[model samples]
Target: MGDEQIDAAALQSWLRAFARSVAEHKATLTALDAEIGDADHGANMDRGMTAVVAELDATEPGTTPAALLKKAGMTLVRTVGGASGPLYGTLFLRMAPAAGTADSVDAGTFAKALGAGVEGVVARGKAELEDKTMIDALTPAVEALEAGLAAGDSLQEALRAASAAADAGRDATIPLVARKGRASYLGERSIGHQDPGATSAALLVAAAASTLGVVVGG
Candidate 1:
């Protein structure tokens, strides 16, 4: 676990941790995508994150989380292949502006920035509820984070809520026929398998929870 502050160091660590998680689950992600997609989600993401980590290692991104995240987004855009590169790159890019110039952000600000990130993904992907996309997991998690923040929960508690919501949303995608992406080409055939994007998105949110010391489902 790391410090609770949403600072540059913490954000960098978050990206690194996420990269590791994606690598660890690469096979599962590709397997899920193989059921209805190009089956390259895992390889593409792994390669991109590897580049991100390398860039992070090579640069001294100062102390601003915004700058760090922006650079990370660009790295993904340049290195990652497939539609995932643009979608994920846009996510971090939007978050970068929301993060502002602050070295650290409070829970409220962090939630707002995260919400902005998800909105970017939605805009870029044009996905909606029950679409069987990453939006399914991301939207619910952002909503839950906001709800928890509104209810005055601690950052950890709010993250836990977000993570749990993301997990539920991921599970919900299991029975849905994808209405977007390559999976949509499968039509009715997509219903039985879980969405690769949604599953990976869940892992991302869970990584945040764990990195920030939130006890997911606790």
Candidate 2:
């Protein structure tokens, strides 16, 4: 059988759903940022995702998943503010090549793309686990997703596991002293504050579970 070209629509839906999730949690993200970092995580991500959706809507559809993700990455880098724009932008940009030339991406391919994207964030931000950054959420989610898939879990189940891991990673950020970004400036004061980047990253994973999980059905 051939690749399911319809998966392109599912990927598109995933991006749009992520935008909506960002909007829904904007206030919460802003509050988290206000606690330790620049108070613009929510606003910046919201703007970035809005631009992503608009760009996708306006531009002709891409021939492959890689092209779509690349376009989205460019929009984010061009539109968003703060350190998040570049970090998040690099994430998608890196994922583009990893997403491959297939018109439709399968569950394994999706996971691989996410892994590549997270690696980009880690490299760009120079962050690791417990750094109180998005990597905190992203790393665990990818690990959990890959683990779940390897264990023979369906895509929906794997995504659910990934979402749970991301949420836990986000929560774990609290009580840790910041080791990166503006939050590090606070030193000991950064302790006890939830990381805004991790919070939004959790949302990103959850959005994938709800959107892509439904469309692909593993």
Candidate 3:
């Protein structure tokens, strides 16, 4: 936000903000997972993001956004527990290349990069809409972001729409039977409970909206 650039520092802030959100919601996330998973999503996410922040702080400020994002991905893969580590890591790793080599990127570029990341999650997790996974949140948010931009909305407006879509997606998962992850083992039993992964993914979008808003001139 200081310089209105979606550069390395901005990306670093995004990760840090996400980590803080994870910490704040850790208990709720864990509770949700306890109903259908190993009850570790919150802890794993918090640990991974903590590591990501540490690594980012140790790196130089002049680093490009792509490098910063990729480093965050690797940190998550190394520090996070469970399948979520790889899946979330893939999201950032895929985004790195899509973000290109620029020191900063425009809102449209960020949208494309974010979409690429979501696709990575989809491919790595092999999950689709209504699968009751993080895909439930990420897919709709990305689609909404793109749609907002296509409609010529400001970046902040697009982000708002994305966040809303993510929240709705998270809530919608409450009625779905999980088709992936440990929750899938529960079959129909997985229904009627909000997906932990989807919930956390919604936080991710919300964090982005909060952290990127000022930078994009919201």
Candidate 4:
């Protein structure tokens, strides 16, 4: 079996779906954040994604995956505020060069890029598992993607596995005590609430499954 390639259109669709998901769940994210940190995750992400879409619309990076992802990363870094801006921005930034200039990217390449992106986030945030942060969801999702690939799954199947793992990681955050970021400030108070960042990370994974995987699967 060979790597599953996704074209520029597929990448665009993935970004669009993620933006839409963030917008649609803005209130929910904010409410979740309010439980342990500042109640602005939703607003920040919504604004950031809106800006990213607008940037993409105006620039239209065309078929170059590296160009598109780099532009997206820069836009996020410039437009988005808070920890998400840097973390998500770093994700795309690291992924951009990793994706190279291919007209389309294979599943293995995509997973490698995603892994690099997660590493970027970890470097920037200095977060670890059970930290009640986005890393909680992202780490498991990446692991699932790798496991799926090792099992000879296609890109769609791998993404599906990743999404499920991300969801599970998000759910698992509910009972965890905060150990990083703003959530850590709450101490025992953060135990019962789900981490907003983890929830949003799951949304991003789900977006990939809904858009990228669906396109590949179809």
Q: Compare the candidates by lDDT and give the number of the best one.
A: 3
Q: What is the TM-score of each candidate against the true structure?
A: 0.94, 0.94, 0.95, 0.95
lDDT, model 1, position 129: 86
lDDT digits (tens) for residues 56-101 of candidate 1: 8986756588888888899989988688999889989999899889
Residue pair clashes in candidate 1: none
Looking at candidate 3, the ten consecutive residues that score lowest on lDDT are 1-10
Candidate 4 C-alpha lDDT tens digits along 1-218: 32667777778888999999999999999999988999999999999999988877876445587778887888888887789899999999999888978788888888899999999999999999998899999999999998898889877888998999999999999999999888888899999999999999999999999877564333
Which sections of candidate 2 miss by over 4 Å?
1-6, 215-218
The parts of candidate 4 lying over 4 Å away from their true place are 61-63, 215-218
Task: Please identify model 3 stretches exceeding 4 Å from their true place.
Answer: 1-5, 215-218
Against the true structure, candidate 3 has what lDDT? 0.89
RMSD of 1: 3.3
Better of 2 and 4 by TM-score: 4
Stretches of candidate 1 off by over 4 Å are 1-4, 213-218
Please provide, for model 2 over 83-142, each residue's C-alpha lDDT reduced to its tens digit, 9 standing for 90 to 100: 999998998999899888878777888888899999999989999888889999999999
